[model samples]
Target chain A: MAEYKGVMTYCEIAEGSLPSISREVAGFGRKLADDLGEELCAVLVGSDVGNLAQDAIGLGADTVYVVDDPLLKEYQTDAYLSVMEKVVRKMMPRILILGQTSVGRDLAPMLAFRLDTTATLDCVGLAIDPGTKLLLQTKPVFGGNAQATFTSDFCPQIVTVRDKLMPPPEPDASKQGEVITLDAGLDPAAIRASLLKRVTENEGGVRLEDASIIVSGGRGIGSAEGFDQLQELAALLKGAVGASRPACDNRWLAPNRQVGITGKIVNPDLYIAIALSGSIQHLSGCAQSKSIIAINKDPEAPIFNYADFGVVGDWKKVLPAFRDKLKELLPG
Target chain B: MRIIVCIKQVPDPQASSSGTKVDPEAMRVIVPQGTPPVMSPYDENALEAAIRIKDAHGARVTVISAGRNLAKPVLRKSLASGADELVLLEDAAFEKLDSYATAHLLVAAIREIGEYDLILCGRQAADTDAGQVGSGIAEILKIPCITAASKVELSDGKVLVERVVSDGFEVIEAPMPALVTASSEIGDLRYPKLKDLQAAQKMPITVRGAQALGIDAAGLKRVNLVRLAEPPRRKTECRIIGGETPEEAGANLALKVKEAKLL
Candidate 1:
């Protein structure tokens, strides 16, 4: 029997340096490695991503494995999965951590299937059981209406975590680790799907993920035109404009601005929810906001339960007055 | 072209925040009786995407659902929405299946169907939200799978899929006999006409079990669901800013927000 040992995090990179998700998962993996009293290993894959090995060490990885190859440049299902399989097979880490982003979501499960182990997706909470040393994976289910904890008696327990749930570890340049470069023996014939073109919808404004404050509207905002008012309010506060799923589905806002379980998870300092009844799925996205303010006519709207301050009224009458009051309160 | 769309019947995901209850003892959600189950939202998009392809290229779209006891009224909607056939893979073991097991069953069923050009599934079920089965099936069958597809077109012996990514979308092309997972952005399931609705209800549904599908239910490893519970509630003492009129209330709310110094 191959005795799986230590924690391994699959590091993701965009442009050149590691993305925040890579750091976040590394931080999370660091905690697990500590609990298990084992080495934390990070795998850096992609074209010329070897420079990030020390960075991963600073994020708490004791050993960083670099598989820098041109064939592994962009995330193709087969290329990345094949790379991950070789890494997992070679190292045989007891635990594997991945971000619930585009690449991880696609790769983790397939890798799990190939390895004959189970992979838990979108896990918001994870812990190592002190008694038997099993990974307890906690994740939301039933449209975020409820959460479930799961465990499997399998080696290399795999998990993909939702974003923004954990902060990245503080970087310490003093930290050092061993970097092992592996040959990515990938075959071009193994690449099944090909990326033709990429289209980026650049909504020129503060990205919801990086925003300190978010002014979000919902179905009650009515139409596409109503978002302009939300945008104005967001601009006044130097924040970003976000929307509930309904608003996005109605084409009133782009899907990227959606804050919910299936959408982007945000942790803005202040979340202003307008004309939106808070659903569990939506709250799963923005509940980490430092403070929430809700405005809706229905006093019983669930948003109030999570709001620090709330106003009961029609947004049509209130928004204009809000603009006026804020305009008077602050300077451009 | 033959298309297979996988759908799951779940407790209404569109239900209000308070519509669900978790039975921790059973580690399952207790769906209230009399509240009919609806097709998971993304599966509807998957069906709609298939129908769009069917309308354009004249392909046969078959809807396959694997569950314990599915609602026919709900399953019929796929047909009413334009699926040409309905196949249900049902067994007691079908309930609360882990992604791997579900994928195992689906791959078996798809094999039984024999020939297929494309396999379409919802990005993830509105229930588990695991989003793994599609990728698993593709892997087990060794086929290319594109997930979170917003737009799919069959063009010149290839499947062109506009997949939803974090920053934007990516146009991916794969050869025939591929799989694609539809995201909600593809568009909601279309409402069927009265004639189509009637025809769908009368449509014959093929039902099979684990034994029939050649799946040894007792042999698979099931991920133990330890417990089900409500997320820890954030108890916020809400201060309702009030005034005589809506405008006055808005002004008061603005002042209160500043006082809070949230940003």
Candidate 2:
């Protein structure tokens, strides 16, 4: 057996705090580390994010590694990679976990490549094989038609977990842990990419992952007006409005709100899929939701196969009436 | 300037595999008949990005791929779509490569190209959906990598790109001789004209095997597929609402959903 040591998680800082996905990953990684009887460590990299290091500890990291530097204020691959590679080489943890965000999706593979290993991306389920003591990474394969479990032969196994699948850890303010700040030796001349500016969409402060209820539309919604109705319903319920890949591909919605295999994986308490034919890829992402209600005109749509309640009707006529009924029923 | 685009051939993603079965003995997914394989959609975006760069600046667009039993029509379609040259790396031993091994082969082929100002690839492959190869190649080649690039433009000896993020998009500028993975926002792939399609048929394709590249044919296996099985199906006795009109059905559904307290 390989003598791997600890469980390390990469905690990303966005808007001066850890994103919801990082909190979920840390929660899951903490349990896995405890099961293996190993130390739980968190890696945080940014300009002035030492405070987030303490937040990671409160969320259950035993040791928090901090790499604070001005060059790392914005995430450039080389600068962050330089710090992470050194940390991994020095610590040599058994398992490396990361949130499957755009940054993680890009950095994990490069780190695994440098370490001569492979990674499992967008994994939905994870468990340890009791006999072999290996991480069993389960992910959707073949465009989400089937599921595949993969294990790496390398010592430090790398895994990128999907967002909204795992629950976020409860923070304990009184928890104490060790924090170590390392010298980030980055040479500005060696970095090739520079951040010019970041442009963000005004999404009204609602993120898809944190919402408990989601009302999603698909291409069958007919036009942008359909999404407007869906948004009205979502607003009434105080939930987020999501869309399928086709809707995003058609520019009916922003790509950020897409929920499917290629987009965000959501685990809301209730998922209302409207005018969407449930493709395997789309189902795989939302499969873990507690309850699902599907609405489509076609009775034979695959969505009904997995939906708890199915309504067959044209969205144009149905959505407006549904909204009116809901408003009437739950008048504040 | 020379631009290299790496494309992959995958089964059509939109094809429903309700009747498809897994060949556990061979470790392959058997697609339903009549669903011809096409270039992965994001890779099509990558090719389009390269061609657009070539159109803006005079550059040669060379497209490359690594797979077994390379399809002629698929590879020719890329050339017809505007790639100046095509290179296919095929071998029996290359069948079960993980991202690491695939990146090794691509980096070798790219090194052979000798002179390239930029390399482009899809954000992720449609089949495995593992988006590791592009970053792997960039890391091995010691070049900068910009991933999930929705828009790419060539400037004076540098490239400016808009990358998709969780919140929105970030504009990044990188020096020449870098790699970028294209997202669907790059734009729709252009259709080849009749003359371009005719010229693509006459264009020569460079094919290489493991032996041709001085690699051991039998020793290239790195990652192993442990098992493949159907995911546990969600069994639900769906209670479908039936009404004379869409409005009636919608009103009933709202009442039912409200009764269930799902909202």
Candidate 3:
């Protein structure tokens, strides 16, 4: 444990740039390393990703390790895991942080297992205990009805944090750091999984994370066509459309459009829930919205408890009038 | 093809919050009286994935579940849905085993069950929601693992999986004998026919304990659960818009939105 003396953030690159989650974990990793009076580092693994070392330094990592390889162009489990295992074995950081995305969720647990350690995934909060120097991982459980904190008694404590949960990294452009390049040691035979292709099928619209207002529906939306109605309203307001887990499970909405404990978290200026009963699972994602409005026939729906405004009616009847009024009131 | 689907029985997530309550002091949920446990929803999706593969190709589907006290009737749904065999890994010490221990036990059971080509599991449990065991089991078995798969297609002794990413889905390919964690995107489990359900109830189940698997479950926990508590409450009094009709309510709701300067 004494040999593992620093914090390491596993940074991810998307479309030739550092994603928001990479910056966030790096920022939070700095605080953890500082608290332990240890160094902070970042591991950048991807093709042509070494150029971001300065950005990593600016983001608070004292040292940046670059593993540049063409084979690492896109994420493949076998290749990424081998690279991560090599880096961790070399750096031996006391704490490892990763973003809770498709990659991290797949990699962290396997990496931890390979190293004979444990990892806490999808953490909403992380803190270093002052007295015992333990990294406490706080996460939601039981469909977000309950919360639990966990601590690992192992080296290189790994945790995958839910994206956007932490404040963004404030880069100091003037900051400088050490950069080291490592070779993954070519062995194509070692990689088992191959990426066939990545398909992007998201409907053209304002991304929910970037939208200021979101029009969301639920089981009551009925069909894909019903979601189209919500999408029209979302377009009218220059917002995005989302749905509860039921709608996503029913395939009425793309799985990515699902907002709940198992889906993406969004915090917009306003969230309009149409015929969706706000279960704790669903609220876990959008409860942080500035204002929530619920339109449901069930006056006793749990959504009303957390909503700022309620309209007890069928959305088919209520939505048109509301959309029509908004069309008349607002200038595009 | 030999596909093994891992499932777990949990307090029905569809049940209202009133059906279950968290016991902060004891660090567990108090199951409501008379509410029968259901297969974790994602696990049902996993079983559905297995059945679909079996439907498209000639394969045998075996369902394996590990827990302290698993309900036979709830697990029988897997058989009714199309599983040919049911294997239950049960023991007193299996109740609170960590993800690694759970995976280790499953791996042992997989080993004992002999030949297998592909393994499937839910993305995460509805109760604990850790989502680690499937990946851990894959790691221990040294096989490629694809997590959060929406569609899995088999061809030429390999599997092409469409997995959900942040913005969309990506296609990944791995050799057979790999593991996949299915998500809701795979779609809901099929409702078994009444005749099938009746036949499943009469099927024999193979039950194994920790001693049979040669694992000391009590010694496998590596992480400490510090405490459990209700998540911070988010509350506000909802102001209901009044109107003579539903259409009027909609018009009035829009006015409120405008008043709030939200649009």
Candidate 4:
């Protein structure tokens, strides 16, 4: 293994701009570097991505590594992983931190396999041991019913932090770091997969992860017709519609709209749990929400504890009134 | 063309847990029996994708699964859904293998089945939700893997697939003999007809042991799991806004939301 003694953070760039998760990872990496008394180096791989390297330095990276190649304009798992593997082999950092975005999810596992190491994914917390210099990673397990803490006995500890797990870094204009441009060894034929086209959805609504107001439902919504009421409420409140695991299981909503540890972790300003008995898996994902509202017929439901507001009446009667009240309270 | 789809039977997501105690002798956890075993929801998507491919390309699709004898019911469901053949990798020792060993065992079974043009699997299993087996199998077999595939189209000599990314999707094109993990959006699955179910009962199913696949079940190791326990019960203190009418309850809830600063 290549031997470089520093913490390396993999910064993801999209549309020639840095993603928010990258800064969060950089902040966490800075903390880890401080604890280890080592420099934090940032690695950026993409086409025409050099302009974003300065943002990484502003986020607390002391050094930035850039692999700018035309072949990397689109992410192919094989080509991207090959460049990452080459960089890691050349500069063997003590720890590798990646943002648990889609790219991170695909690349981290492949990189770990190539490096013959283990990668802890979707970590919600991170800490470094001063004496041992080991990275302690914490993540929810068993569909969020439990949390597990793990550490690697091997070198080059790798962890992927879930999005929004850490606060984004505060920028300091006065801080300037060195930028090193490296050649990305690219072989087009080596990339088994090639991109043909990209289709993006146009519908606009609150993104589940970043939404401030989330109005959610569960299996008790009864039918597809019930979703119309939930959607109407979400629209009236300028919020997003989320579903519990049971709702997703019943195909009441798309899996992408599901909220839970296994689904999406949401920290909304107001979380409305409608016709849903809160399960542990669902609670773990929404526990960080500022306020929770439970609307269920069963007065003894588990969601009441997490909910700041509770409505014991049936949703059919409760939701319409609630929607009208919100309209009166905040006219749009 | 022959396509192989590896599936697993897991507890239904909605099933209540079987009351298995973390410390059974000590009376720790009472996880009631979870829902009955069924073809994993994700795997059903994979199976549906495979069936679509067969219908469009006239390909032979084989459904392969690993589990206890109780899994026969679940395996029959796959057969009823239009799989041309069924193979069950069964053994008492196969029950406890982790994802790594599971991948190895599946690879051995695939090798025993001879050459195949393509392989498909669910992105992850519902029970463990590991999302590792498909990738691990691809790694072991040294083949290209496209995961979380939202769309797949085959033409000429290449297979085109769109894998879901965080911000967007990354479209990938791979040659035959590639592996893909189906996402939920692959297609909507159809329920089996009565005729299909009856025909599935007459379909031949080949059951094999781990030894037949050249995997030493004894070598499999459990990395962790001191015990299993039920998740802690959530405590709820219901604050019933006692009101004679729904509007009064709505007002009371509005007050609570304002006090909580949820507005």
Candidate 5:
């Protein structure tokens, strides 16, 4: 039998707490580590974040690396990557995993370049091959038309798993693990870029990627003015508004509201695609939605194949009726 | 100043899957025959940025491409668009090169071309969407790289770039002879003019082999194929239940909203 090294999961911080994606990665990482007969280690870098370190251990990490630094309070790619590079060089783990969030997307490629390694981003699945001990990374490819599995015969195989790929870890507080503290070694001069200001979207609801219910519009929504109806419908459902590439391309909505390969990947519990013809790029983003509702006048629209239910009619006429029915079924 | 723009040709985004599996033996992806190819969207941005820089800084732009012989047409397209010269890095050796190896080959080729004030590439190739090529090139060349750049300006022998960051943006200034990956907003792409298109038809294209780049063709190996599976199917469950009239439907929708626990 071949011996296996441990797995290092980058426990991401969000909303001043451990993001749900971190627990999901930890749960999956724990299973992989257990199968390999190795421990799961979690790494956390933040300012005075020792208290949050235990949650990672309770989730699944057998050991937690805590780098408490005042400079690490906010996410600065250069600073974080610098510390991560130092930590990775010291630990030399077999596999390194992170959540495929915006931060992860920004850091993974840079880190890979720094480490002189290759990383597969937005991975949906991961495992270890028993014979070669290679970490098998699977991710959507070619604008979600296919899934590609990749492996590197190199050390510290890295991947970033998308959110909701795995169930959140069930906490086991009784299972205690060791927590080691380290200084992140962050120097102000090391920071090359300075944050000017953060401009968040003012009308906030659930983020499309993380939302359970999503209502989307497409070119068939007709005009930018038509989006208000979709917004009204989305508000009625307490769901978020998403747009097909055409809608975004037409500037009917913000780029962040676009759902497709170039936009945001969403897997909502219920996805309502309005007046969408279902272009592959648009479908790629919402294909993972638990249940898809496509409302279009064209019955032959490509989106029908991917949708769970279809309503062939004018969206301007159909959406309000559908919204009312949904409201009828689940009244506030 | 000399600027090098790395360009790649990809299938139209609207086209069906032409991606094959990792296992060459069991490859099942049907490469669509007679599919129209386009300059990768990101590469278009790269080309536009290169043209803009050339117009402002009086630099000569060289278009570089790596692919099979079939990529000649794609290379010519770049030349027609405004590039001063074209170099095609073609060989069986580059057939299976991944991002890392591809970057190495490109760096070697660039080194052979001698000094350059700047290198420009798309933030990512549309087909693979790996987004590692530019960064990998920067690493190999040991130059500062700015990725996801929405805006770029040259002043005082330095490149000032606005890199897209989460929440907002950040400005980074690097010295000349830097590599910058361009984002879509860099500039609007221009179509090839009649005169340029006519000239492009007569333009001489230079082709280089992998051996010339110091990479052993046999060393380019694909380790594993992640499976190529169809996208998950989505089922639309849309049903219409309200609206005696359009106005009635809106009122009913309001009532339904209250009933649905969503209001």
Candidate 6:
């Protein structure tokens, strides 16, 4: 067995900028590295994301490895995997961490299989076992009904942490780190997959991760028209409009707007859930929010158990008046 | 064309949490009361994807599952749902195989089946939600793997897939013998007619074991669940608004939200 060394985090870039998950994972990786008495590193793989190394150092990484190549501009599975495999083999990190995004979900498994290692994805909690020095990865299973902790007796324990579970550490601008640029050594011919084009869909006004306030609707929303009301309220508050799985499955809202275990996990300042019964799956996603408000017609809805404020009534009648009251209270 | 679709049966996810319990001693979940084991919802989507492909290209669809004491009714339901054949990879030792071992076992079964053009699986099993086996199978087979595919088609001898991305969807082209993990967006599974259900009940299903597939099940586990417990419960006491009508509750809730500074 190869002797394990340090903790490394794979940084993700979106829309030509580093997503908050990169920093969040860095903070998380920093803690794990400190506990293990090893170095913390970050791998930035993109065409021109080299400048991201400084920010990564500020966030937590002591060493930033860059794999800059034009062929790596857009995320293609084979291309990214090739670079990651090379990096992991060279660094021999004891632990590897990634964001539980679409790309990470696809990449982590393939890499783990290739490395002859094991990975736990969409993990909510991570800890170190002082006894054996293994990563204790906790994630919701059976749709958040129960939690299971897994440990891998292998080098490079790979884990993909759910977004927003931990806040990124404060960055000191004066902090310095070593930024090393390495050749991706990627040959386009060796890659079996190629990106023909990229498409960007127009999501609702605010991105789920960046929203401070969110208004979410569920099965009780009735139809696409019902979501329109929720959208109006969200727009007024300058927040995002999210939905439970049923809302998206019914095609009343876009799949990306769904907020739950199967959807985007959010931790906003305040989450206003309307007409949602608060299934364990949906609650698991937003459980980290600072405060939650539930509005449903059923007085016995499960959402009430986790909500700070509850209202029992028809959303159709309640939403309009609530929107109007909000318009009155915060006149812009 | 020959297509293989893998499916797993799990407890219905929609079952109320009140009946769900965790057995820390066994480090496993006791299925919620009154919830029968059913085909995983996402696997239904995968089966639907296979049926659609078969319908389009005049192909044969074979559904395979690796588990312990595989239920007959559940596998029969899949057959009624348009699968041309059913194969059960079972063993008492196979009961607790992780995703890695599961993929290896499935790969061996596929190899024994001899010929296949495409393989499909659910994006993730609802039980573990590891979402790794599909890609793992693809890696061992040295085939291109696409995940979260909402749409898949056999186009000019290549697999054309529309996979979901964070922002939107992307269409990818891969050669034959590729693997795809179907997502819920693939559309609803087709309901089998009464006649088909009756016929499926009489059809012979093939059963195989780890010895038959030449895999040592005990040696393949790369990860294991160390402990299991119910997630910590939220400790918020919901303050229900007192109101005579929906309008009254709405107004008072707005005031309360304002007081909470959550508006």
Candidate 4 lDDT for residue B215: 82
lDDT of 6 by residue, B1-263 (tens): 99999998777777645568899998879885788777888889999999998888888999999899878787789999899999999899788788889999999999988899999999998888888999899888888888888789888898888887767778887887889999888887999999998999999999998888889976999897888999998899989886788888888888888888885
Query: How much is the lDDT of residue A123 in candidate 5?
Result: 85
| Residue runs of model 4 more than 4 Å from their true location after superposition | A1-5, A35-38, A127-137, A150-156, A219-232, A244-256, A277-281, A298-302, B17-31, B67-70, B91-96, B167-172, B187-189, B193-204, B216-238, B245-248
Give per-residue CA lDDT, model 5, range B153-176, as digits (tens): 787888788765433356677776
**Tens-digit lDDT track of model 4 for A75-138:** 7788888899889888889899998777777777667656756576777778885675677776
Worst 10 residues of 3 chain A by lDDT: A162-171
Q: Per-candidate TM vs. native? A: 0.97, 0.95, 0.98, 0.86, 0.87, 0.97
Report how far residue A48 has shifted in candidate 6, in Å.
1.3
Clashes of 4: 13
User: What would the per-residue lDDT of candidate 2 be over residues A248-304, giving only the tens digit for each residue?
Assistant: 777788878888887778888989999998888788778788889998989998889
Compare candidates 3 and 4 on DockQ and give the better one. Answer: 3
Better-scoring candidate (lDDT), 2 or 3: 3
Sliding window of 10 residues with minimal summed lDDT for model 5 chain A: A193-202
Local accuracy of candidate 6 as per-residue lDDT tens digits, A42-145: 99999999988898889888999999999998888888998999999999999999999989999999999888888999998888999988999999888888
Of the true contacts between chains A and B, what fraction does model 2 have? Answer: 0.74
Query: What lDDT score goes with residue A66 in model 4?
Result: 98
What DockQ number belongs to candidate 4? 0.31
Worst 10 residues of 6 chain B by lDDT: B10-19
lDDT of 4 at B227: 33
lDDT of 4 by residue, B51-164 (tens): 888889888998888865646866798888889899999988787565556777888889888888789998777666556677777777878888888777788977888776
By lDDT rank, best first, the candidates go 3, 1, 6, 2, 4, 5
Candidate achieving the largest lDDT: 3
Error of 3 at B207 (Å): 0.8
What's the CA error at residue A209 for candidate 3, in Å?
Answer: 1.6
* CAPRI rating of model 6: medium
Error of 2 at A216 (Å): 1.5
The candidate with the higher TM-score, 4 or 6, is 6
**Model 2 agreement with the true structure over B59-159: per-residue lDDT tens digits:** 89999998888787878889999899999998887775778878888888998898999999999988888898899889989889999998999998998
> lDDT by residue for model 5 over A7-79, one digit each (tens)?
9999888767897888899988998898788889999988878998889999989999999899888776668
